[model samples]
Each structure stands twice: as structure tokens, then as C-alpha cells.
Target chain A: MDMSVLIALPVIIPLIIGALSLVALNNHGVQRILGVLGTAAVLVAAIVLLWQTWLNGIKVLEVGSWPAPFGIVLVSDLLGAIMVLLAAITGFATAVYSLKTVRKRFERFGYYPLLHLLLAGVNGAFLTGDIFNLYVWFEVLLVASFALLIQGGERAQMEGAIKYVTLNLLSSALFLTAIGLLYGLVGSLNMADIAVRLQQVEDPKMVTLVAMLFLIAFSIKAAAFPLFFWLPASYHTPQVAVSAVFAGLLTKVGVYALYRVFTLMFTGEVDFTHQILLWMAVFTMLTGVLGAASQYEVRRILSFHIISQIGYMMLGLALFTPLALIGGVFYIMHHIIVKANLFFVAGMMYRLGGSFELKQLGGLYKKHPGLALLFMIPAFSLAGVPPLSGFFAKFILIKAGVEAQAWWAVAIALFVGLFTLFSMIKIWNEAFWKKAPEPAIEVPAPYRNTALYWTTGLLAAMTVAIGIFAQPIYVLAETAAQQLLEPQRYIEAVLGGAK
Target chain B: MTTMMAILIGCLYAAAIYMMLRRSMVKLLIGLILLSNAANLLIFTVAGLERGVPPLIAKGAETVVGGSADPLAQALILTAIVIGFGVLAFAVVLLHRAYEVIRTDDMNEMKGTD
Candidate 1:
């Protein structure tokens, strides 16, 4: 009834269920029930929590009877709550989609538990108030992801999983090192505790070094420029359902952490962090788009765009303004829904045809009109066409960039938008419009059309809804942005003195 | 002592980086182990080395600045070292399978999804 339970439950319940899911290792039916029931519960909890946080201010949950700062705390501020909400939605959609693909047995035994555990890790990272605990949850998910990534043990999966594990392991090490350094310097792991104590640390160089360590760790996780190579190479090899959930949700977690830390704790420590972030944003945007354009594969192009879109998010972060933050948060929400939709479409494409290569497939629009429309709406939205969620995201971002007098960032984002359009169109033209391959292959795949029908319909509807009623969502994003900039509110709530 | 530790750690890190750059999965595994050790040792050094005393204020002991080693950081490092071993175990299992299935430790052949 306190509403904060919803926030803690999204993590706690899934984790509990994840543990329980392992018991049903021999019973796929039990695993399926646990997985779907657990995630659906978490999804419902996230929605209710978001609604509650919107009504009330920020909800804080302290573990064990320990007081805040000393005991670990989970805070569901507007931004974090919204992040959980989007993750829950995308996660649930993928779950439904997975019901069809992940074989009944795998669902019951391994898939469900790993999936729920991953969600728990994601939800926990979003909600935790303690920085050390954030690192712990990150490891929880990364380790679980490692298991999930290699569970099937396909040669392709193993190869990609190796890169994924190595890169993430290095990043996690850097993250912990940074944490150890910060703790050495500030003697506190709570985000609020550090923000307060950081001001007392007089040496600017030490501050910059600590901030750089954090930036590298988060940037690598976010797949920003220079640290982005592992993403596209690895993401495509996983199961479509797994990849769908990951594409929509995981990298955004990195973006969420980056935004939370920089905006709240390191706002004052800006000379090096902000400049490095700014240049990184520019290169990330350009390189991401260029990467997307060079590829002929639908998923590969979309994969690359994930890197580019993160640039826009970082641009918002580096700008350190209310509007820019709003744009960043808004883009995150829009990206989750649209990106999940696109990947689902890619999965659907693979389901129909034997391959995702544009050269191998053709004339999808003729066979599957409904699927074509499904692909069209989110694609158009992802391209930032008018009246869609993507447009609103970019509009606010460009406006915020211009307002911040960040013309170069604004220019790069605009140019990237064009390339995004170009790539989306390329996917459209090559995968759907090009002629059906030799011999007019009949019944290309069994799973294709069913997936295409349900997924495309659901995602396209959501994109349109966001486009139509952007006001409420915009207000939510602005509120979340406002909460982030005001460290006192977050600090006080977590440090136990205030509401 | 600090200089010797720093040099040893530096060499470990360099070896780790070189191994990381190699195509063979086994070499990469070795590199990760060395790098992690170097990192752990660096953390130990930064925590400030001391000969004795253990940093615990046991029952009205003399309160001196250099009296005990920083036990908290030591405990943390111990925990970190254990976790590093767990990672190594997982990596070995993973690499063994990678070689079995892929038939080569060369990462380039593993490129691109099937």
C-alpha cells in the first residue's frame, strides 16, 4: 500500500523467482509459469510504481533496519521509476514473443530463470541508491548474461559471448577500480554521501581522475565511441528474444547510470568529464550512423544505430541542462519501445525468411501487408519522421543542443538523423521491396508470420500512442530531469533526513 | 618497496595488455589473470603497506599513526582476489568449450554470426 513496495518488488520478486526458477530445471512448464508470472508481476509493479512516484515525490526503501547511507537503500525517483517502467514493458513484450520461440523445455528450465535474473539485475541497478550496490547488481546481471549468452553453446554464440564477456569484464574491473578509488577518496558508497563529501576533497586533479575512471566504465557499458566495437559484433549472435530484450533494455541501463551519476554527483566536477563526454558524443553519433549505413543486414544496421542513439543521450547528459536532460530521458523511453519493435521485426524477418540479409530476401510487403505496416511505423518513428515519438525526442534534443549553444552537437545529431533515415530506408527497400529470392521460396519459415503479426501490431500501436499523446510523457521526462539536477532532494531522501 | 611493487605491477599489466591483443583465446585468458593480479596488487599498495600491527585497535593499544596496516582495504582486497579466481575458473571452462566447438583458438575465424 505504501507504493514504494512496487519499486523494491520489481527487483526483489524477480530475484526470488529467479532462484525459484532454478528448482524447476527439469520442468519447463513450471519454469514457464514462474518466468512469465514473475516478469508480468514485475511489469505490473513497475507501472504501478511509476504511477505512484508521479503522484508522490520519491520513494525510498531501506534494507534490513539499517538507516539510509549506512544500510543499502533503493530510491525510486521519477527517472529511475520510468526506466524500470520502460524495461518492464519491453521485457514483457519480449517474454510474450519468447513464449513462441524459446522451446517449451528451455523456457521452463534455463531461459526463464536467466531472463528473470537479468531483469532483476536491471531493475536493481535502476533502483539502488548505494553506488557499491549498483556495481554489485551490474555484476549480477553481467554474470547472468554470461551464462545466458553461452547457455546454448552454439559456436557462433560462444565466439560472440567471448567478446561480450571480455569487454564487459574489463569494464566491470574498471568500474570496481573506480569505486575503490572513490571510496578511498570520499569514504562513502552512497551517491548522496559522495556528492556531499566530494566538495570537501580539495584536489581538482584527483576529482578528474576519479571521474575519468567512471566515464570510461559507463561509456564502455553504454557502447559509446571507442568502447563500442564489442556491441554489434556480439549482440546479433544471441537468440532473437534475448537480443530483443537486451537491445531495448541493457545499454539503456548504462545510459541511466551515466546520467544518474554525472547529473547528480559529478555536476560540479565538469572540466574534464564534460569535455571528454562532448567530443565522445560527436564521434559516437557520426561513427554509429556510418556503421549503420555500411551494413546491408537489418539487425546489424539497427545494432549500429544503438551506438548512435546513445550519442544523443550522452549529448543530453553532457549539456547538463534541464531541457537537454529532458530530451535524454525522453529519448531513452522512445528508444526502448522503438528499438525493441525493430528487433522484434528483425526476428520476424528471420522467422519468415531464412536470413536477415537484405540481399537474400524480397517482396515482404506483397506477402505480409500487416507486417509491412508494423515495420513501417516504428521504422518511420525511429527515423524521426513527424508525429512519431522519435521526432519529439529529436526535436527536444536539437532544441536543447541549440539552446545550450552546442551547435556542433546539434549539427552532428541532425546529420545522424538523415543517416538513420537512410539506413531505415535501406532495410525497408532491400528486405521488403526487393523481389523474392530464386524459385519463389514457399513457406520460408514456420515462425515468421505469427511473430510478425502480433509484435508489429503491438509496437506500432505504442509508437503511435506516444506520438499522439506526447504531453504527459514529456511532463514525466521533465519531472525526472528536474529530480536528477537537484542532488539535495536525492541526497536527503537517501541519507535519511528528508522526504 | 613501493617502487618494486609498482614495477612488478606495471610489467604484469603490460603482459596482460599484450596477451589481450593476441588472437589465441588461451593467451587472452592468461593475460586477464596477470592483469587482474597487477590491479589487485596496485590496490594493495595504494591502501598503504605496513609491516605489522594489523590496524585493529585491540583493547587500549597505543594509538599511533603508523601503528597498523589498513585492515579494511586488506579484507576488501582478499574478497576481490577470491572473486578474480571465480572469474578465472569460468573463463577456463568457457575457453575449453570455445576451442572444442570452434576447433581453433584464433578469434578471427569466429567472426560474424552464422
Candidate 2:
């Protein structure tokens, strides 16, 4: 199989499916089947791409064969391949979950097509080697997400959409400004070309200034400290399926961009740039956990946790060593699976309890023990319980921080983990263990949605599998970290020895 | 020319920020438009202004003739403008719909979810 087509499939397949779904918008059944099949195809393509990239170093595809540094390129290394695969998995799960959860009114508004388009944008953002193309893909995703967020046009959704759109538009403007300045300085928009040209830039301060602009832009996207207000403010208002997918994949894209640019383009000012990142990571961690602790709503707490977990990944990047980067990569993989599963559980709890407000719900353990146990898996995993995925993710990061002699970071990571457990426990007590405050008004005897439960259970099972089989995945993450740390192979592969 | 454009861009950014910070959703949309145009202008001015000549080659020439504008910057700004327009259109419709549903344009009043 040609690796170029394989590298391109993750992006191309989704766009094709999205367009097809758009045409068949009136036929809900056909759209559902197409959405499922489309995501399945993307998952297979992403897996094959990852497998091939593992065997052969990096795969580069130059559109129209215009040659490196001039043509738009799609380069898939270990990191990009990993992200694409995770996205495909998340997309597939969300598509299945949406089949049961998304309202007919929303689906009639072309939900399937918009969701697939968002996936295409995500995969394209991951695969693009051209920086400007990354911006375009970001727009593609943002537009689709804006539509999806306000699909039903509810008051809450509209309010959230306003904030989401306004803030994201501002971020996009900043991103464009940064790209323009970078092009002015480097005379190139291809990432590898920029890296090569950036080395010759005489004024490091100017480079640092541009780097800060990029940091702010991507940080807003990633929902880092002081810039994360939009995330919790908007995330909880969307449908569970929407929030689940957004929770799993959206902020991770921002983290991916941050890692890509910092590791590849801004290494010259690591001391200045990464130090700011390090402080941001600490504040992000502290504020996120503290915010989660104060939240009584299940989804809002989960949304805040997303910000907190992002801090751990940023810490890995700020440390900027192979071990820390490995931890970061592993954390991203672990967090996505666990976070999405937790949101799915929250949805089920809503079905069971009739509200997301923790104080209004109870008796799930007495009624549905299976749901309680299933929820425990991801909830405990998110709080870093032993022998689950989150524990390993936190352990590796804390170990890396300790090794880096960043004791303050280690302390913060540990403290945040404890508070995370507190919030998780709060949810457990309120939603499952505590007795129902009143007789369940309209609660069904037994939950019967196989699609939602199966998807949530499968993801929970994956968290366990990743934890028990952590060694191989760790080795893969180590390789990804090495690739990020040493960019010679990446540059050479993309430029074809031009440098 | 570059310095004057830089100052203009700076003013646009300042006005955009000011409008964006207003409580009304309409002001935010206006701010986004200003900011996006400011970004396009920034790209154009920073890439350097070359007038009179177009970025085209003589019929048999291998490369673009000298003293022509950088076609890449123009192409980038064009793409940015189109994308910006699509987003702005979406924002306008979304805000209109939001206003219809929520019955308020003030951002603080629209905090039903939070």
C-alpha cells in the first residue's frame, strides 16, 4: 500500500463521507449508517498509518508533487499517527453514541455531516505539515463545531455558542497574526522549512515575541490557565455525545499544536518560552482542580478536570526531556479515553437521575450496580487510582518531574491528583452511593441503551488494558518523545535532504 | 508605507479589543471583523509592499519577474479573507438565532448555562 494515500486517508475519507452524508441529509437512517462506516474506515486507516509509520520512520506526502518546502505536505510521524488514531477511535465512539442520544431535530440539522467534517478537520490538523494549512483546518473544525454546538438552538446552547464562537474567533485571529509575522520573518509556512530558516534568525528576542503569540493562541485553544474560561462555560451545555467528543479530542488538538511548534520551531528560546509554559502549567493545574472542587454539576466538574489534566500534559512539554515528553504523550492517550468515558457515564447518570446537579441524584448503586461499577472504572481512573490508566499517566509525569528536579511541579501534580480524587469521590457519593432524596419520579427500572453502555464500557476496558499493558505503549510513547526531542529525522524526511 | 500600515493595524487592534470587551454580542461580532481585517492588513504590510508589477512570469520565463508583489502573501490573505467571511457570516446568523432564543444580546444576561 502506498503510504502517501494511507497518510492522506484519515483526512480524505472523512471529508468524502461528510459530503455524502450532507447529500443524504433527509434520510436519517442512511446518514447514520454512513457516519458509522465512515468513522470505522478512518479508524482502520489510522491504525494502518500508525503501524506503517512505526515500521518505516516518517511518511511524507507532497500534494501535487511540488516538492518539499514549496508544496503542501502531510507528514505522519509517531505523534501525529497516535493523535489521528485516537481521534478516529473517539469519532467512532461518538458517532455510535450519537445514534442513541442525539435528538432527531439536531440530526435533521445535518449533525452527522457536521460531526464528520469536524473529524476531517481534526485529522487534517494532525497530518498537515504546512503551518498555514493547520490554520485552515482549525477553521474547518471551528465552523463545524459552532454549528454542532448550537444544533438545536436552545437558549443554553446559544449562550454557550456565543462565548465559544467569540473566543475561538479571537484565537483564530491571533493565530493568523502569528502566522503572518512568522512568514514575514522566515519567508516560509511549511513547518520544517520554518524550523530550518528559524535557526538563521539573528534576533532571538523577535522570535521569542512571535513564540509568545503562538503560545497564547494555542493555549486558548488548549484551554490553559486564564484562557480556559470558555471551556467550562460552554462545554457543559452541549449534548453529552457532543461534549464527550469535544472533551476527548478538542483541547488535545491545541496541545498537539503546542507540542509541535515548541519542539520544532521554538527550541532556540526554550528557557524563556518553556519557563512561561511551566508556570502556566502549575496555575492551570491549581485553578482547574480548585474549580472542579467547587462545582456541584457532574459535567461541569468533568469539564474543569479537562483543564487540570491538560496541565499535566503541558508539564510534560515544559520539562522538555524525552522522559517528560513520553509521559505527556502517554497522558494524552490515557486522558482522552478516560475523560470521554466519564462523560458518557455522566449522560447515563442523567438518564437515571434526571439531573446533572449532584445533590439532586442518588441510589444508582442500589438500583443499577453495573452502572455504578462501570462508572467507578473511569471515575477512579481519572483520579489516578492504582492499576488504572490515570495512575500510570500521573506516576510517569510525577516521576519525570522528580527526575527533572522540578519539585514544585511534582508537588502540584500530586496535590492536584488528590483534589481530583476528592471531586471524583464527591460525584460517587452524590450520584451513586447516597440514597435517593425522593422516590424516582420517572426513572426506568432498567437502562436499555446498548449502544451507549457498550461504548462507555469499551472505553473503560481500554483504560484497564492500557494500564495493564503499559509497557508496549510506553515504548511507543518513548519513541514519539525521541522523535519530538530530536527533529533531524523529521526535518530530513519532510525536506528530502534539502537542508 | 509599512510603518503607516503598522500604525493603522495597531489602531484597528485597539478598536477591535475595545468593541469586543463591550457587553453586547453585536459589538463582539464587529470586533471580530475588525480584528480579522487587521490581521490581513498585517500580513500584507509585513510581507512588504511592492506595487505596479504583478507576480507573473513572462510567457517562457522560468520564474516570476523582479519587483513584483509577493503573490504568496496575497494568496494567504485572500484565503484568510474568504475564511473570515464564512466565519463572520456564521457568527452573524448564530448571534441572531441566539438573540431570538435568549431574548437578550448582552453577554452577561446570556449566562444561563454558567
Candidate 3:
């Protein structure tokens, strides 16, 4: 089998399945089956891709055989492959969760197809090597997300989608302008090619200017501090499945781009650029946890925590050591699983308790101790509890910060963890432990969707497993961080064979 | 010619931002349209303006002639324009739907979700 064909399967599988599901759009059963099978297939393909990339080094596939520096290339290094694998996991879990929660009306209106398309877009974004191709992939995911967010077209979803659409489009425009400026400076769209060319350029200031453009554009997508209003405003408005996948995959793409560019191409002015990133990391942590602490709605609080956790990942990057990068990669992997699982648990709570408002809900501990247990795993894991994934993630990052003597970042990160714990405990107290303010409607046993619990429980188990088996994953993150720090290997792989 | 194009692109960007700042959703849509065009034109201008020469390979030639314009930038602009158009189309429909559902064209009134 051609290695390139294997490389393309992650994107191709979901795209083909999405189109096929569109053909069967009216049949909810078929859509459900296709959605599950498609994500599972992509999951299998991603596992294979990750295995091959780990066994070998970076895998590059040049589209149409146009050769490097001219054609679009797809490179799956360890980091990209890891992101794809995590996306597949989230997509598959969300598909199973959706089987119970998603209405048939949404299925009839092409929810399954759009979900597959979003996966395809996300996988493409992860795998593409061309800067321009990355922009196109961003649009692909953004459009699919816009459609998915507006599904059912309730008034609030409408309002949220409007902000989502406008803000994201603005970011896209900025991304395009930056790409244009970059092409003018470097004359190549291939990221490896640009990295090579950019080093030889006479003007460093111009490079810094374009770097700032890319930074601002990507920060909006990553939902870093001040630029994150669009996130909290809109993320809580979508369907739980949509919000789950978005929470897991979308912003991470932006973070992945930041890691790729800053480490690979824009390392010239690290003192200046990374200093800004360090400050951004500190403030992003402060503001996001504060925002989460103030939110009473279940998903909104989770949404805000998404921003806060992103701060830790950025801290890992800003610290910019091999160890910090390892922590960053590990944090992203753990955060995706834990965050999406948190949303799933929230969805289950809404199912059993009948509202997302923490104030309106209570007494889950007595009625459904099982559900309370499910929530506790991911919630505590998210709050950096010991022996869970978030604790290791935060530990490594703070360790890296301390080693680098970034005292402010270290202090702020520790402080934010406390707030994260506070928010989690607030939810625990309000929704699970406290007395019900009113008589809770009894959800019958049959309404307790076994599939939902199974999916959420499996993810919670993965979080615990990642924590227990942290050494092996830590080794993988170490290798990935090493690869990121040393870009010559990546460049050699991409452009090495070219004449 | 390059300077003129640069000035025009700047104006387009200025106008787009100005319109985007308005409270009307309709103006926001128009601003998005202008903003995308500004970006398209910026790509064109930055890649260096050329007149009359089509990026083409002569008969039986292995590559385009030396004087022919760079086709890659144009191709990039073409892709960006198509994507921009698709996004703006979606934005138009989204804003319209938002208006119909929220019962207002004023962006301030759309704050109920926040």
C-alpha cells in the first residue's frame, strides 16, 4: 500500500462518509450508523498514521505529485498525528453520545453529515503542510461549524451563530491578509519552504510584522484572553454534541498552528514574540478561570474553563523549552479528552435533572450516585487533582516554568488551578450534593441512555488511564517536543527529495 | 501602478472596518464583503502588479516565460475569493436569519444571548 494513500485516509474517510451520509440524510438510523462507522474508520486510520509516523519520522504526501515548495503537501509528524487521533476519539464518542441526545429532526436536517464534514475539516487542518491549505481548512471547519451551530435555529442559537460567524470570518480575513504578506516576503506557500526562505531574507522586522499578524489571527481562534469573548458568547449555545466536539477540537487547531509556526518558522525574535506570549498566557489563565468561576450555567462554566486550560498550553509554548513543549503537547491531549468528557457529563446531567442551570438543579448524589461519580472523575481531573491527567499536565508545565524561572507564570498557574477547583466544587455542591430546590422530575430507568453513560464513562476512564500510564505518553510527548524544537528534520523530510 | 493599488487597498480596508463598526447588521455584512475584497486585492498588490501578461506556457514549452506574471498568487487570490464568497454568502443568510429571529437589525438588540 502507498504510504501517501494511508496519509490521505484520515481526511478522505470522513469526507466520503459525509457525502454518503448526505445522500441518506432523511434516514436517521442510516445517519447514525454512518456517523459512528465513519468516525470509527477515521479512528482506525489515525491510529495507523500515528503508528507509522512514530515508527518512521514525518510522513509527507505531495498532492498531484507536484513536488515540494510548489505543490500542497500533507505532513503527519507526531504532533499532527496525535491531534488527529484525539479528534477521532472525540468524534467517535460524540457520535455515540448523539445517538441518544440528538433529535431526529436534526438528523433529518443533516446533522450527521455536517458533523462528518467538520471532522474532515479538522483532520485536514491537522495534516496539511501548506500555509494556504491551512486557511482553506479553517474555512472548511468554520463553515461546517456555522451550519452545525445554527441547527434547529432557536433564537439564542441564532444570536450565538451570528457572533460566531462574524467573528470567525473576521479572523479568516486577517489570516488571508497575513498569508498574502508572507507570500510576498518568502515567495513560497509550503511551510518548510517558507522556513528555509525566511531565514535568508534581509529584513527581520518585516518577518516580525507578519508574525504578529499570524499571532493575532491565530489567537482569536485559540480564544486567548481579550479575544475570547466570541467563545463564551457562542460555545454554550450549540447542541451538546456540537459544543463537545467544538470544545475538544476547534481551538486546539489554532494552538497547533501556533506551535507549528512559532517553533518552526518564527523563532527569529523569540525574546520579543515569546515574551508577549508569556504575558498572554498569564492573563489568559487569570481571566478564563475568573470567568468560569462566575458562570452559573453548566456548559458556560465549562466553556470558560476551556479558555483557562488553554492558558496552560500557551504557557508550555511560551516557556519554549523541550520540557515545556512536552507539557504543552501532553496538556493538549489530556485537555481534549477531559474537556469533551466534561461536556458529555454535563449533557447527561441536563438529561437527568432537566436544566443546565446549576442553581435550578440538585440531589443527583442521592438519586443517581453513578452519574455523580461520572461527573467527579472528569471534574476533579480538570481541576488538577492528583493521579489524574490534568494534574500531570499542570505539574509538568509549572515545573517547566519554575525551571525557566518564569515566576509570575508559575504563581498565576498555581492560582488558576485553585479557581478551577473552586468552580468544579461549586458545580458539585450545587448540582450533585445539595438538596433539590424543588421536587425533581424522576427520569425513568429507560430514559437513562446506556450509550451516553458508556461513552462518557469510557472517556473518563481514558483520562484516568492517561494519568496512570503517564510515563509512556510522556515519552511520546518528549519525542514530539524534540521534533518541534528541531525543525531541520521536518524541513529535510519535506524538501529533501526535491530536485 | 503598484502604489495606486496599495492606496486603494488601504482605502478598502479602512472603509470595511468603518462599516463593520456600524450597529446595523446589514452594514456588517457589507463590511465583510468589502473586507474580503480588500484582502484579495492586498494579495494581488503584494505579489506585484503586472499588466497584459497572462501567466502561460508557450506552445511546446516546459514552463511559463520569464516575463509572464506569477500565477501562484493569482491562484491563491482565486481560492481566497471563492472561500470569501462562500463565507459571505453564509454570513448574509446567517445575519438575515438572526434578524428574523431576534426581530431587530440593530446589533445592540442581538445581545439577548450574551
Candidate 4:
């Protein structure tokens, strides 16, 4: 297959599937089958794309046959390929899990179509080589997520959607403003072209100013520190399938943008820019974990943990070393799978206990040992327990921090892990170990759905597999980090010897 | 011209921020519109304003005539405006739905989720 066609398939597959699913709107069964098949297809394509990039280094496709630096391009370096692969995994898992969990009402309301549209937006964001195109893709995902969040249009969903919409709109506005300033400064929208042009610009201060604007704009999107209020307030309001996908993919797109811009474009003032990122990473971790500790609801706790985990991933970028970037990439991969699996497990808990409120739930350990085991895998991994994927990810980051002599960051990272473990244990003790509350509700019939268990088990097994096979993944991350740290290779690959 | 535009953009931004801080959701929408327009104008002004010079090339010319306007900025603004309109429309509809369900125009009333 041609490289250009292969690079575009990750996006084209989802776009075509979403459009086709729209035509099959009235048929829920058809939409469900199409959703699973669509994501599965993208998963396979992502594997091929990753393999091609791995073998050949960076692959760039100039759209419409326009020359590089003038036309939009799709560049797949190792980091982009890894993210695309991770997104496909989460997308496929959520699609299969939705078969059992998503209601017929939602399915008829075009759930599968919206899900695929969101996937297309995500893959486009991961693959696009132009900065402005990234903005367009962000709006795509935002719109799809907005529709997904308010699916049933209940009072609670509307309430949540309002916060989600308003905050996201504000962020988009800022992002657009920053993009305008960047284009004004660099005279280019292609990220690789801008990276080349920016080095010749006379005003480093102006460049830093625009860089800060991008940081604040993306920080809101990424749910970092004070800007993260919208995440917890809204993420738990959606259906489990929707929230699981959002948890796994949406905020990570923001983090990926941050990583892309900071490494590739804003490196001239690293001490200034990354220093700010360091502080944000610290407070984001502390506040997010503390917030999770205070939440009593199952999904709410997980939502806050999502914010905290974002801190760990950001810390890798903030450190801005090869080893640190590797840890960051590894953390992103591990977190996407583990977090989505945890959300799936939460869905199952609600199935059996009929409540997300911890006070109303108990005795799941005695009732369903298998479910308990499923929960333990992701939960322990999330808490950074030894031999789990999260452990290796965290260990490498801490080691990187120590090597970089960021003592305070290392100390805070350790404490955050402890607190994360505390929150996980809290869930275990309250939801599984404690006796059943009075008037225990009967488990729903659909709780026996094999598809749900299979999907969740698939992700959990991935978490364990990643932990057991850390060496190879570590090597991949190291290569990705090397590519990220060196921008000239990326620029050359994208521009094709033009500059 | 650039100085005038810079002032106009600043005013729009100030008004946008002020309106966004209001209690009414309608004001918030207005704020968002102003914010996006201000951004578009900023791009237009910063990309260097020019007059009566089309970005088109004459027949058999290799490149655009000298001092022609930068077409890329206009293209970017067009795209941004389209995206902004879509997002604003969505936000307006979402606000309307929230008002219908929550039965309040004040943004404070929707704080139950928080």
C-alpha cells in the first residue's frame, strides 16, 4: 500500500464509518456492529501505521500533492504512532463495552456515529502536521464530545454539559487567539515550517509570550491545576462508555498538543517555559489527588484521579529530558488503558450495586470474586503498585527526576502515589470489603453480559501484559523520546529537504 | 491603521472579558462572540494590512504582484470564523437547553453539578 494512503486511513476509516453509521441511524443493532467493526478496523490500521513508522522512521504525506511547508501534511513519527495505537485500543474497548452498556435510546440517538466522529477527530489531531489543522480537529472533538455529554439531555447532564460547553468554548477562543498570534509571528501554520522559521525570528520574548498563551489555552483543555474544574464537574455525568472514552482520549489530546509545541516549537526559552510547567505539574498532582480523596462517588473519584494522572504525564514533559519523556510516553499509554478499564469496572459496580455512591454499596468481594479481580488489576496499576505498568512508568519518571535533580518534584510524585493508593484502598474497603447496606438491590440481568466482562478483561489483561513486557515498550518509548527531543529530524522529515 | 486596529482589538477583548463575567448566560455568549471576533481582527491586523492589492497573480506571472495582501491570514480568519460560528451556535443551543431544563437564565443556577 502507498504510504500516503496508509497514513490517512486511521482518520479516513473512522470518518467513513461515522458517515455510514449516520445512514444506519434507525437500526441500533446495525450501529452497534458498525461501531465495533469500525474501531476494530482502525485498530488494525493503527498497528500497520505504527509498524511502518517504526521501520522507516518519520513518514510525511503532503495533502493534495502540495509541496511541504505550503500544504497541510500528515506526519507519523514514533510518538504520534504510539498515541494513535493507544487511541485505537481505547476506542475499540469502549465500542465493545458499549454494546452491552449503551441504551437503545442513546444508540438510536446516533451514539455510534458520534463515537466514530470523535475517533476521527482524535486520530486527526494525532496525525495532522499543521498547527491550525490541530485547532480544527480540537473543535471537531469538542463538538462531538459536547453532543455525547448531553445525550439524554437530563437535568444533570445539561447541568454538566453547560459547564463543559462554556469552559471548552473559552479554551477554544484562547487557543484561536494564540494561533493567530503565532501565525502573525512566524508567517506559517505548518508546525514543522514554523519550527524552522521561529529559529530565525529576532524577538525571543515575543515568541515566549505566544508560547505562554498556548500553554494556558492547552492547560485548560488538559485539565491541569486550577483549570481542571470542568473535568470532574462534567465527566461523571455522561454514560459510562462516553466517560470512559473521554477519560482515555480527550484530555490526552491536550497533553499531546502541549508535548508537541513545547518540544518542537517553544524550546528557545525552556528554562522559562518549562519552569512554569513544573510548578503547574506539582499543584495539579497535589490538588487532583486531594480532590479524589474527598469524593465519595465511585466515578467522581476516578474523574479526579484522571486529573492527577495527567500531572504525572505532564511532569515527564516538564522535565524535558530523554528519560523523562520516555516515562511520560509510557505513562500516557499505561494510563489510557488502565483508566478506561477502571471506568468500565465502575460501570459493572453500578450494575451489581445499582449505585455509584459508595455508602450504598458493599460486599462485592464476597459476591463476585471475579469482578473483584478485574477491578484489582487496573486499580492496583493506577496506584503504581509493583509489577503493574504504572509502577515501571512512575519508577522511570522518579529516576529521571532524581537524575535531573528536581528533588521537590520527586518528593511530591512519591506522596501523590501514596495518596493514590489510599484512594484505591478506600474504594476497595468501602465498595467491596464492607458488609452490604440494608435492602441490597438485586443485580441487573444484564450484569451477566459476557461482552462487558470480556471488554473490561481485555483492557485489564493489557495492563498486566504491559507490566510483564515493560522492556520492549520501554525501548519504543525511548525511541519516541529521542525523536521528540530532536526537532530537526522531525522538521526535515515533514518538509522533505526543503529547508 | 495598525495602531487603530490594535486599539480596537484591545477594546473588544476587554468588553469580551467583562461580558463573560456577567451572571447571565446570554452575556456569556455575547462575550464568546466578541472574543472570537477580536481574535480574528488581531490576526487580520498583525498579518499586515494592505489596500487595493489583490493576492492574485497576473497571467503568466510566477508569483503574486508586489505588495499584495497576505492571503493566508485571510484564509485562516475565514476558517476560524466558520469554526467560531459553529461553536457559538452549539453553545447557544446548549444554553437554551440548560435554560429550559434548569429554568433559569442566571449561570449561577447551573452550579448544582459543581
Q: What C-alpha lDDT, on a 0 to 100 scale, does residue A28 get in candidate 1? A: 71
What is the DockQ of the complex in model 2?
A: 0.89
lDDT of each: 0.83, 0.92, 0.92, 0.92
Tens digits of per-residue lDDT, candidate 1, A1-499, equal 5555566888988889988988878887777677667778888899888988889888888777477667778889999999998888887787778866786645644787888889989999999988878987887788777777776778878888888878887887778778777877886777888989998898868977888888999889999998998888878877788888888988888989899889777866676688789889889989999998888888888889999999999998888889999999999989999998899888887777657888887888887767788898999898899899999999999999999898899999999999999999888888788888786555543644464467557878889988889998899899999998888888877776433
DockQ of 4: 0.81
* Clashing residue pairs in candidate 2 (N, C-alpha, C atoms within 3 angstroms): none
How does residue A317 of candidate 4 score in lDDT? 97
lDDT (Cα, 0-100) at A152 in candidate 3: 86
Better of 2 and 4 by DockQ: 2
Model 3 Cα shift for residue A387 (angstroms): 0.2
lDDT of 2 by residue, A253-284 (tens): 99999999999999998988999999999999
Q: Return the lDDT, model 4, position A162.
A: 76
Across B1-114, the per-residue lDDT of candidate 2 in tens digits comes to: 878899999999999999999999899989999999999999998787988887889999999868776889989999999999999999999989988988888888976776
Pick the winner on lDDT between candidates 3 and 4: 4
Query: What are the runs in model 3 whose C-alpha is more than 4 Å off?
Result: A439-448, B57-66
- The digit string of per-residue lDDT tens for model 3 on A6-82 reads 88899999999999999998888888999999999999999999999999999999888889978999999899999
What is the alpha-carbon lDDT for the whole of candidate 4?
0.92
Q: Top model by DockQ, which number?
A: 2
Question: What local lDDT does model 1 show for residue A114?
Answer: 87
